[model samples]
Target: MCWFSGLIALSMLVGMSSPSSAQSTAEPAKGRWTSLFNGKNLDGWVMKLKGSDLGENYKDTFRVEDGVIRVSYDKYEKFNGEFGHLFFHQPFSKYKLRIEYRFVGEQCPGGPGWAYRNSGVMIHSQKPETMSKDQEFPVSIEVQFLGGAERGTRPTGNVCTPGTHIVMDGKLITQHCNDSKSPTLRGDQWVTIEVEAHGNGTIKHFVNGELVIQYEKPQLDPDDRDAAKLLKANNGEKALSGGYIALQAETAPVEFRKIEIMPLDD
Candidate 1:
C-alpha cells in the first residue's frame, strides 16, 4: 500500500456526534487519560454494519469478552463482505488516543485476500447515522492495522484514506494508503498503537511508543462520492477537524484493549 509520497496539511477543526440517536459525550479533564472501553460492556459504543442500520451488531461481530473488545465472525457461516464498525460515538477534538490491539485466529471463509489480518481505527469519521445502508466504509482517516504473514513486509500502524485525503509539503496525497516506518510485528502479539491527533491540525502515529508516521491536514477528498456529499452538507467545506472514533472490522478477527485518551488543550 506504499502508493503515496507526500502528506497533507489543513486547519479546520470540528467535532460531530450521532451515537445510537443519543449524542452523549464525556468531558475528560485536560492532561488526564480517560478510558474509552470499560472492559466490562459496550456501554458507550454504537455499531454499524453494511446492509444494516446504524445500531446493529450484525452476527455479533463485535463483542466484549474477558474484558476486551473482540471482533469475531464465529456466527457467520461465511463472509459476505459485510464490513462493520464499533464507534465510541462521542466526538473528540484534540487528544492522544491509545489502543492495544492484536490479531488472532484465521480469516473468515470467503474473506477478501487484502483483508487478511487487517483492520483499523477510523478517526475523524462521519456520523454513523448519516452513512448509507450499503456503504462499505465511512469517510475517515484510517489508522490501518495489519498482522504479519509468512511472506514479505507487512507494516502496521499505517494510514489509509477511505473518503479523505492528507497533505504534506503543501501537496495533496492522491493514493489510498501510505506505509509507516514500523517493523513487521509477526504473530498474535499485543501491539500498542497510539495516535496524537490535534483535531485537524496534525496527526502522528506511534507503534510501541515509537513514532512511525506523521502527517498533517486531514481533509475530505472532494472526489469521493461519500465525501462529496459531506462537503455539500457542510456548505462545501472539506477541512476535517473532528468527529467520532471507530474500530474497523474487515474480515479478520482482532482484539482491542486499553482504549484510552487524554484530551489536549488547543
Candidate 2:
C-alpha cells in the first residue's frame, strides 16, 4: 500500500476525521490557543434558526460588522419566538473557550421580556446538522451572559441547561437555570466570558477571569425530545463528554468580538 494511504488508515484507527474546508471543522493541536473567528467573515460557522433549514441564516439574523459578529434584527418586522444559534463547525472534547461580548441597541420588536441583554454560549452541543427543523435549541449546556443594571444583580456566566442536566456538590441539579456568583454587569461595556470544560468531568464559568460557577457530570435529559434522540443514538450514554460550541441569539441584540479556544488534555 502507498505511504499516504497507510497514514490515512492509521489516523482513522486513532479516530480523527480528515478536515474539510467546506466544513472547516478541524481540530487544533493540544494546548494551543486558536482563534475560531477570522474577524473577516463567517467562513467556518453555520446558522440554524427556528422555522429554517440547518444552513439558513434566517433573514440575516447573524452578520459580521466591524470585525465582530452581530446578531441583527434590523430587517425583521417582528421577533416571533425565533431563537437561533451559530455553531462552530467542529467539536472539542476538552478545552477552554473565551469570548468577549456586549449588549447592543434595543431588542427586536416583540422580543421576550426576559431576553433583554440576555445571550449565551452553548458547550457540548449537538451537531447542527442533526438538529430537527423547528428545534428551538440544541441539546447542550449553556453559559448564559446577562447585562443589566447593577442594582438588579443580573449576573453573567450563569448555567442554563436546555435539554441537559448536571451534578454539583455531589447532588444532581435538575433545574433549568442556575445563577452564577458574578457581579452585576450593565450597559454596553464589553465583558469577557470564559468557559473551562473538561469533557464531562468538570465545567466552569468565569467572568473576567474570576471563577463564577462550577459543575460536573453534564448529561442528557431523557425527557427532552432532543436529548432523547441523542441518547438513542449514542448507546444511551448519559454522561456527555464533548461536542460543538454555539453562540446564542435569543431575541436579544448582542455582539461578540472575539472567540478563542485552547484544547486541553483529557
Which parts of model 1 have CA positions greater than 4 angstroms off? Answer: 1-18, 21-27
Per-residue error at 156 for model 2, in Å?
0.6
List the candidates' TM-scores in order: 0.91, 0.90
lDDT of each: 0.84, 0.83
lDDT of 2 by residue, 1-266 (tens): 21112222333221124223254323566787788888878888888898898778888999999999999999899998789999887777789999999998988989888888889999988777767788999889999999985466798999999899999899999999999999998889999999998887899999999999999989889899888876666656677777778999988889999899999987
Q: Clash pairs of candidate 2?
A: none
Question: What tens-digit string does per-residue lDDT give for candidate 1 at 111-155?
Answer: 999999999999988777778999999999999999999989999
Q: Which pairs of residues clash in candidate 1, taking residues 3 or more apart in a chain or in different chains?
A: 7-167, 7-168, 8-166, 8-167, 8-168, 8-216, 9-217, 10-217
lDDT of 2: 0.83
Candidate 2 regions exceeding 4 Å error are 1-27
Highest TM-score scorer: 1
